[model samples]
Target: MLDLNYILSSDYYKKELERIDRDNSVEQGLYFIIQSLLRSTIEEKYWVTDISTRSKKHIGFSKSVPDLTILEDGKTLFNPIAVAEIKYFPWSKKEYLTNNERQVKSYLKQVDKVIYTNGIEWIFLYGKGGSLERKESICLGNDRNTPESYYECINKKKLLSQIHWKNESDFKVSWDDLICKLGAFLK
Candidate 1:
């Protein structure tokens, strides 16, 4: 399980969010938080990285580049444990969901676990569940606001609050539970 307090209390987590707030294009800040979560939950060595830069062969299908690739300790490129697609909150709601969903479905064709997220909201996807499958395992922010409105309301406090928020669905998974699910995906 991930240590939420350890991540939330870290100066790095706080500072990175501030930096992300200033420059939406700098995705590396997310890596720090994700690495912290992985470090706490999994025992084996793993890498949270952008494999697009690795080599021509590693670039995803149709020249698409996923935002992050989680490689297990002994896993090869053919079998990454998980991959993610991230968008900045200010992007249009339709593009954020529609385009990203297309991209995530493409990813799911190869990788079993795919995480689609804006900085505030996370949606987990897995292939091969058929009609009964719930592509989104859990969401953290659980807000109904549109992407633009959500971005407009962002601040350090709001960001932290959203990160700590429970899932909106009947299941109501907490941050700790979400992290544990993520940990399971990586394992």
Candidate 2:
């Protein structure tokens, strides 16, 4: 289980997320949060050796850059097993989700799995039939207006899973559940 008390109470976490909420670097800020969670060593099966935030290139013809990538064995330079992208969609969420999927597919063909999130929703994608398919999706927030971080969202309502396609559906996520979802993503 993850130590939610430490993360949610930290002033630094709130300040950093607020900064991300105001800027275009949503992916970087999300990466910072995830990296911090992994550094907490909450999981015994997997340990995040490296996580690149839009700096590492996906091994493909286009050499596209994903928003976030987690490397299991940090020995190789580009050994990325899982990739994630944090998108901010304040308008036309469906359109943004479609576009983000395209962005993930363009670069992350060889990666094992991918996570696409907007801090409020998390979409897990898997490559299938030469395309990226939505494996699962969950909404961890009810308020769509100001969902810039997990702290803001979870404090508001009940935490549920798999509320992505349902409109007006409110779901929440615990820190341990979030870590399990992202930690086992590579496998």
Candidate 3:
């Protein structure tokens, strides 16, 4: 299982959150955070990278630059395993979620799997036979309006303790489950 306390409380994580709070390179900060998480958990054969430049050719995704892309064997865009769309804190706001979900669903046209997250809530979706299905929705914690609130949440261990599966109201989610699910998805 991944070490939630260490990962969440690390100096790097704290710095990234601070950068985000300052609104300095928000996308890059989010990318770094998510990249570290993916790199730490994913298999060796999988490469977690950012392909957010319009100049780069993502084949099927011409107009949109996916926040993060997973390539099998570090081969390139030709062998994409998954794509992640990241947002900032309070990304669960209805308007943001709705628009982001629509974008994620569009990615399903070419990629088999897509993840939409706000550094807290992870929505996993998979493409079927010309259709998209929401595989899971995992919430690491309840919404924190500000970055300081995040510090409080982690300090109090509320982030880990408040875990729950979005779809299954009664089901409690654990760090192991989060790591397992995300690792399995990437693999």
Candidate 4:
């Protein structure tokens, strides 16, 4: 189990959120959450500041800031211990679809797990082929219109653990739970 308080209250995360341009609210929120999770948990062994630069030679293009890039230990040179990418969103929509094959392939080539999210939802794309395997939602100000019990549903690990994104159904986790999980992971 991860700690859930420190992450939600971290000064670094708060500052980052404040610094982010409001125009990219969804990206800012998603970055804050993922950064909090990585900083609080995952004891990062090594990280690359500009992943786009590192990926340029292989992908033939560069990105402005990929949100976050992390690497874990590996048993063999050909395999990555853990790798992920997080994309924030204010809501769920097909318009945000990421079909950049070159970029996706670059990520898959470098890491074992690739994760993406909007502030409200999280999608995990795993394996070398980048399969969408799991997803979760966060209960936040935008979700205020939803019933309170919906948040409770996310807190129940049993319910969350059973969710699989492969079915193509949206996975919902409350913003409160997102904060809690991030807090736990951050600590």
- What are the RMSDs of all candidates, in order? 6.4, 8.3, 7.6, 12.0
lDDT of 4 by residue, 1-187 (tens): 9755524443344334333323233344445455555555455454322243344444322332244655433433233344445543223355444454455555655554554554334444555544444444343322222223534433433311121122112222343355555433312
**Model 1 stretches with alpha carbons more than 4 Å out:** 1-15, 23-25, 91-95, 129-132, 137-139, 142-173
| TM-score of candidate 3 against the unseen true structure | 0.69
TM-score, each model?
Answer: 0.63, 0.59, 0.69, 0.46
**lDDT of each model, Cα atoms only?**
0.56, 0.51, 0.63, 0.42
Summed backbone clashes in each candidate are: 0, 2, 0, 16
List model 2 lDDT by residue over 1-187, tens digit each.
8545423422354344445554433345566665565445334434444334334443331445665555554334365566666655343555765655556666456575776766655677888433765577655443244465645543544333222322322222343355577556655
- Number of the predicted model whose TM-score against the real structure is largest: 3
Error of 4 at 54 (Å): 3.7
Candidate that beats the other on TM-score, 1 or 2, i.e. the better one: 1
Least accurate 10 contiguous residues by lDDT in model 4: 159-168
lDDT leader: 3
lDDT of 4: 0.42
Ranking by lDDT: 3, 1, 2, 4
Question: How far off is residue 32 in model 3, in Å?
Answer: 0.5
Question: How would you encode candidate 3's per-residue C-alpha lDDT over 114-184 as one tens digit per residue?
Answer: 88876666778888533676667776554444445545433442222222223333223444566678788
